[model samples]
Target: MSTPAAAAVSSADGVAWDLADLYAGPADPQLDADIARAGERATEFRNRYEGRVAELDAPAMRDALAELEDLSQLADRPLIFAHLLHAADSSDPANGALVARTAEANSQVRAGLLFFELEWLALPDDHTEPIITDPAAGRFAHFLRKGLAFRPHVLDRPVEEALEQKSNTGSRAFKRLFDEITSGLECDVELPSGPQRLNESATLALLHDHDREVRRAAARALTVTLRSNSKVLTYIFNVLLQDHNVDDQLRSRGHPMQARNLANEISQESVDALIDACAGANGMVQRYYRLKTRLLGLEKLYDYDRYAPLEQQDGRWSWDRCRQMVTDSYAAFDPRAGEVVEMFFEHSWIDAELRNGKRGGAFSAGGPADAHPYILCNYTDRARDVMTVAHELGHGIHQYLARDVGYLQSHTPLTMAETASVFGEMIVFYRLLEGSRDAGERLSLLAGKIEDSFATVFRQIVLTQFERAAHAARRSEGELSTERIGELWMDANAPMHGDVVELTPDYESWWSYIPHFIHTPFYTYAYSFGHLLVLALYATYRRQGPDFVPGYLEMLRRGGSASPRDLVAPLGVDLDDPRLWQRGLALIGDMIDEAEALAAGRD
Candidate 1:
C-alpha cells in the first residue's frame, strides 16, 4: 500500500491539468471578465435571433449555429475547469462552491440560448435542408440530430425556461445533498495500524486485504455508517424520484428508463437484450467464484473474498514501470494509439495519485475541443492501478482525436464512451498475459483480468437490476426502508453469484456504498455494455491484428456524430444481436476454462 505522504506527492507531482488553458484559474482577472462577456453574448444572441429564426435562410441559419457554438465554447471552458477541479478533490469546500456557482452560471447561459435551438427545430425540413447542405453545418450534424430527437419533448420557451430554473433546486440540489451526506460518513475500522477513519474508497480497498478480519470489519463499518445515514439518503431518493416522475410526465415519456435510453441514444430493446444476456451468464460467474474459493483455500467463500488478492502477494509496480507497460502494450497493437497515450505521461496531463480529500475512483474529464482532456485517479502502484491508467488514457486519446469535430459532436454518448477505455485495458492486459514466463504469474494475470471483466460486466448488471428494483418499488409504493433496500440488493446479487459465494447478511447493505446509485441511476448497465463490446472487439483484434486499428480509430473519430450501430458496423460488429453479446460471454467462459485446467494440472 502507498503511504499517505507518497500519495500526496503523487497528487502534486504532475501539473494537475492546466485548466488555466481554459482560463488562467478561478482567480484570474480574465476569467472574471469572460463570465461577464458571456452574459453579454447571450443577450446579443437572443436579441439577434430569438424570434426571427423562421425568416433566416440557409446561410443565416448556418451562421446562427456557428455563433451559438462560439458562445457555448466560451461559456463551457470555465464551467468545465471548475467542475473538473471540484471532482478531482470534492473534500475541498472551495472547489465544491466553485462547482455550484459555475453550474448556476452555465444554466443561466443555457436558458438564454434555449430559444435558438427551439426555434431552429421548429423550422420545416425543407427550410433546414439547405442549412444541412452547407459545409459549415457539417460539424453541427450531431447537434441537429440531437435537437430533432428531442423535438417531441421540447416545450415552449417559457415552459423550458421554468424547467431549467427549477432544475438547480430540484434534482441537482438533491444530488449534491446525497453526495455530501455519503462522503461525510467516516467509517472507524480497526486495522493492523489501529483504528482509523475510512472514507468509502478506503473502506473498499480493505475488501482486497488478505486478512478476512479486515474485510469483515470494513463491511460492518460500511453497514453501520449507511444505516445511520439512511433517512437522509431516503429523502434524497424520494426528492430525485419525484423530480424525475414530474419531468417524465411533463415530457410525455413512457417510462423513466425511456428518457435515459433517449439520452444514451440507444434503443430500449438493445438494453433489454444486454440485460438478458448478462442474466444468462450468472452460472459462469458462479463457476469463477467457485474457483476463487478453492484458490483462496476458504471453507466457504464470503462476498468480501471476491476481490481478495491471489496468495497475499505484495507485488507493486512503480509508476514508471506502469507507464512503460501500458505504452508498450498500446504500441504493440497500434503505434498511433501508443503515441497518443504517451503524451499523457510525457506532458504531465494525468493526476494519478491517492490522497485524502481527493475524490475516489478514476475518471477522464475536460476535453472540450479547445483543451486537452485531463484524467484524475487515485493510483497506488497496484497492477489494477496500471489497468486504470490505461483505461483512463484510452478516454483521453479518444477525446483528443474527437476534439477535431468541435465540442457538441465530440462528446460521445455514455454507452459508446466506454469502448475505447475498456479496449485500452484489454490491450495492456493481453500484452502482459503473453509476456508471462511462469504458470503462477500467468494464472494471476488471467485471474485478475477476468475478475475485472466480471466486475465491469456482471457486477454492474446486478447494480442496474438493483436500481431498477429500488426505483420500481419506490414508485409503486413510497420510500423504501433501509432493510427494504438491502433486501432488494440481495435479490439482485443472489442469482448473480449463485451458491459459490455466500451472501452474508451484512453484504446486502453493500449497495449503500455504491456512489453510482446516487450519482447516476441505471448508468451501471453502460459499463456492462461497454465491457462486452470491448471483449468482443478485442477478440476480433486478436484474430485480425493490426488491421483492426484503423476501423477502431474511425469509430472514435465519429464520436457522437454516429449511432452505436453505425459506428461498429464498419468493423462488422452488431450490438443489436444477442449473439454478439454471447460471443463476449463465451470469451469469458474460455478464460474460466483455462483457469480451471491450469489449477487441475497444478493439483
Candidate 2:
C-alpha cells in the first residue's frame, strides 16, 4: 500500500522575495518618517473635522472621506512592512520590535480619528440617506452607506478610542505572543536518513509524504511539541476568548459570530443557511472518505492518512514547473489573469523559501492599494503546493486589479475576498485534470481535488463550530481546561468524519496551531463560503463557455464597491438561495463520482 518516496525537490530553495519596493529594510529611516507623517495627518484630520462630521454636506463629506483614505493608506504602509518582516522572521528581535512600534503607532492614529465614525454612526437614516445618494459624495458613496450597519454596535467616541489605544498591549500583544511561540516551535521528527529538526511548516508538509510512517512520525512530533506548550497556548486561547466575549458584550452584539457576519456584509440567515447546508451534506463527506479508505487499501483511515497519494509516485512539483503550469493555465483562462500573475513572479513579490522562524501556512497580503500585494507561502514542491501558489496568486490578482477602486473600497470582505483565489485554484486544477495521461493519474488528481474541497468546505465549518463551542464554553463554564477545549474540538470534528476516518487522540491538539483562530475569530467560515461560491461559479463558467469571462473579470474589478450580493449579481447568481449551496455540494458529489469511476477503470 505504500507509494515510492521521491527525492525532495529543492527548486524553490533560493526563491526569496525582494521587499525593497516596500522599504530598503526594517531599519530604513524612512519607516519612522512615514509613520510620523501619517501621525501628523491624523492629528490634522481630527482637528479639522472632529466635531463637524454629522453636520457636513455631501461635498464636504466627500472631501473628508478622500482625506481619510489618503491618510489611512499612508499609516498602513509601515505597519504592513513590519508585519511582512515579522512573518518572514519573527525570531528577530528588531522585526518584532518594529511590529510592536508600528502597531502602537497605528492604534494611536486610529484613536485620534475615532470620532469620525462615531459621529457618522450617530446620524439618523434620514440625514445619512441624502449624503449616500448624493452625486457629490462620489466614490465615497458606498463607503458611506456601509458605515450605517455599525450604528447599533458602535461605542461612544471616548470608550472606542480607549479600547483602540489599549488593544496594542492587550489582545494584540497576546496574539503576537502566540505567533512567536508557534512559529518558533521546532519539531524533532525522525527521518530515514536521521533525526531532523524541522520548523512548523516543514513538519506539516511531511504529512503528505508517500511514506505513512513518516506522516505518523510528523503527526506525533507535532502533537508532542504542541502538548509541551499546551499551558501557554491554552492560556492564550482563554484570554483571547474572554477578550472577544467582553468586546461583544460591550458592543451589544447578540451572538459570537454576529460581529463577523456584519463585517462580512452578509446576513446572519445566509451564513446560517451556509453552515446548515454544509452540515446537512456531511453524508457526502463520509461517503467520500469511505471511498478514499478503499482506494488507499487500508482497513481504516487515520487522520494523518487523509492526504495519502493514491499513485505510486510521490508526484513532487518543481518550482519552475509549478510556475509554468500555473501561469499557462491562467493564460489559457484569460491573458490578463496570466499577465497579472506573472507580475508577482517578475517583481519578486513572493517569499516561497522554507526556513526556520517563518510563519506556517500561506497568505496573499493586500498592502495599501497604492502598492501591490505580496504573497507568503512555504513551497515544498508538492502538488498541493502548486495549488497553494495558484490560490495566493488568485488573491494577488484580485488585489492588483481592484487598486482602481482606491484604498478604502478596494478591499473586499472575507466572504468575497476568497473569490479570486479559489477561482484561480480551480482554473489551474481543471487545466491539470484535462491533461491527465491515464485513468490512474486522472483518479489521483480527482482524489486530491476532492480532499482539498473537503478541507475547504467541510473542515472550515468544523473550525467555526469549534470556535462557537469554545466561546460558549468560556462564557458559561468560566476558564476552560485544555482537556475541555480538546473535547470541544473533537465534538465539532466528529460529524465530519463519522466512522469513515478515525481521528487519533493526538488530533485534538492539532487545533492549537491554526493562526486564524488567534488572528481573527469566526474567520474560518469565509473559506467555506468562498469555496462553495467558486464551485458554483466555476460550474457557470463551464456551462457558459467564453461568455463568462468578462462578467467574472468585471466582478473582481468592482471589488468591495458594492455588497457581496450586489458584487456577484452581474454573473447572474443568487447568494441567498439555499439551492445554490446545494448545487456546490452536488458538484463535489460529481467529483467523487468521477474519481470512483476512474478508480474502477484502474482495476
User: What lDDT does each candidate get?
Assistant: 0.79, 0.90
| lDDT for each residue of candidate 1 in 32-134, tens digit (9 for 90 to 100) | 6767888899999999987898887656766787888778888877778877777666678887787788778888989998998888788878777666766
RMSD of every candidate to native, in Å, equals 2.6, 2.7
In candidate 2, stretches whose alpha carbon ends up further than 4 angstroms from where it belongs are 1-9
Candidate 2 residue-wise lDDT, 1-603, digit = tens: 112111134568877788788889987899899999999999999999988988899999988998999999999899999999999889899999999999999998989988899899898899999999999999788888987888899987889999998999999999999999988888888777666777788888888887888989989988999999999999999999999999999999999899899889998899889999999999999998888888878999999999988886958799989999999999899999999999899889999988777888999999887789999998888999999999999999999999888899999999999999999989999999999998888888988899899999999999999999999999999999999999999999999999888999999998899989999999989999999999999999999987999899989988888899998888988897789999999999999888878777767
Ten residues in a row with the worst lDDT in model 1? 2-11
Best candidate, lDDT-wise?
A: 2
lDDT of 1: 0.79
Off by over 4 Å in 1: 1-18, 124-136
Q: What TM-score, to 2 decimals, does candidate 1 have? A: 0.94
